[model samples]
Target: MDKLRKALSGRDNSDEQEEERGNIMTQTEDTPLLRVMDNSTLSWNTRVKGFAICFGVGFLFSFLGSVFLFLPNGITIFAVFYTIGNILGLGSTCFLMGPVSQCKRMFATTRIIATIIMFAALAMTLVSAFVLHNKALALIMVVIQFLAMTWYSLSYIPYARDAAKKCFGSCLDL
Candidate 1:
């Protein structure tokens, strides 16, 4: 946790370590860390980037999934969409970590919205699967995806708010 704090602040405790070694600490006001901490707008910019990336991924998933649906071989198309969707969704979350770590409120809000959308999407997919009465492979994939999304949202929501509070005092603050 201390390491995380240091990385997020872009600061090192070398000055303090030097002081303990009977060495005098030099003040470096022109350091990048100083500039970063002094500028509140950078944080806001990061949040904007984060939100855009998340929304873009969701859009891509929907578009690609729709396209795949029109292809031949129902089971194969569903499998492709299921695999790609999960991979892309997880990858996008990894990208969001930078902004999420910096802007807690924005992260929490976006994550919650994403969770809700994921739930709805899964529900709709299940209904479609049942109606289509296609191959068992597609149905099995949907069930797996449903379980994964359900577990992810359930576990994520329970701690997301607390993590946001610990990372930042208020939403949209630098």
Candidate 2:
């Protein structure tokens, strides 16, 4: 025990000397915010889960769109459009997370413009089909189009923002 104590005592003195001379970097071993951004950064496992969920959801919707596109009488075209848009939207949301939130205002305009154009085109198609007496088509189109866009935007945006904010920080010490 004496020998062990002596060894530990010697090592501690060397560390203390290094610290005193500023030759060693002192880490904040007790700082709670070392890796956490705003105290809400997710754990590694949570980030992995979020990425997996986004990828899986996007793939599922895109595959569903493909299947719906091949249905008889083109009845499922609306479903196809909706699924396609949402899949793309989800993917884009994941890609452009940095820009979607208020942190990056420059890209917000482009994101908003593209979304409006996409939804407007969808609405126009629905209107044309309804006016031409294609009730089945119009029903499929309008319901899915509106709901898919709304659902994707509502569910994905906040999630992306949170994840991005956690992964990154509003300010960097560097």
Best by lDDT: 1
Off by over 4 Å in 1: 1-44, 47-51, 98-134, 159-174
> For residues 115-146, what per-residue lDDT tens digits would candidate 2 score against the true structure?
55546646655565546557465555556565
C-alpha RMSD in Å of predicted model 2 compared with the true structure: 18.0
Query: Candidate 2 has which clashing residue pairs, if any?
Result: none
**Model 2 misplacement above 4 A:** 1-41, 77-81, 84-107, 122-174
Cα lDDT listed for each candidate: 0.52, 0.48
Worst 10 residues of 2 by lDDT: 94-103
